[model samples]
Target: MERIPILRMGKFLLITIQVDMHDTTALALQDDLMAKIARSGARGVLIDISALDVVDSYIGRMIADISMMSKLLHARTVLVGMRPAVAITLVELGLSLRGVKTALDVEKGMELLAAALEDGDAADQD
Candidate 1:
């Protein structure tokens, strides 16, 4: 079994799953991640997929599902660290991501989350 580590950075949570590049693990991890995010009440999420080499339809749909569920939980989810080859494969496979957000790296995803958090704070103050 692989380890799925979840870390909290400010209002953002990062979930890293160490698993084979397969959809089975991805789907299971996605469910666990969603539960953790909902329970933590995180404002944002960064899913580090840097270790993954393959992105099949199931995995893509799971990612998209998590993104939608995260929004319903009042948290934004971003898929980060996807390799160009994997990205191209996913696109070529015709896997629709719906409205899921993605970033080239975790740093950019964090920046986006921080900006959103600032905006949320401002809106709360007004």
Candidate 2:
């Protein structure tokens, strides 16, 4: 069993998946991430998946589910560092990742997340 580490930066949670994930590992990550978000009251989540070369349908759904779950918990989710090949594979596999947000890399993901959080703050203030 592999445990994914969830790091906290201010009000955001950062998870860099450095290992090839099996179904069990992906499920575990989903569970662990939700727990961490609940415990830390994180406002955003950044998932870096640059290291992963393959993402099957199950893994694709897991990613989308994570994003939806984060939104349900009032946290914005940003998937980052997806390789071009992975993107094409995902599209061909028919997993649009419909409601999930994505970025090219971690730095850009962080910026995008910050902007989203700022927008949420503004919405709240209004």
* Backbone clash count for every predicted candidate, in the order shown: 0, 0
TM-score of each: 0.86, 0.97
Q: Per-residue lDDT of 50-101 in model 2, one digit per residue for the tens?
A: 9999988998999999999999999999999998999999999899999899
Q: How close is candidate 1 to the true structure, as a TM-score?
A: 0.86
Which residue pairs come into collision in candidate 2? Answer: none
Best by lDDT: 2
* lDDT value for model 1: 0.82
> For this target, which candidate reaches the highest TM-score against the unseen true structure?
2
Provide the overall lDDT of each model, using Cα atoms, as 2-decimal numbers: 0.82, 0.93
Q: Write the per-residue lDDT of candidate 1 for residues 1-126, one digit (tens) a residue.
A: 454677988788997644664555666677777788778888998988888888788778878888888888889988899888988898889985869888888999999888888898899999
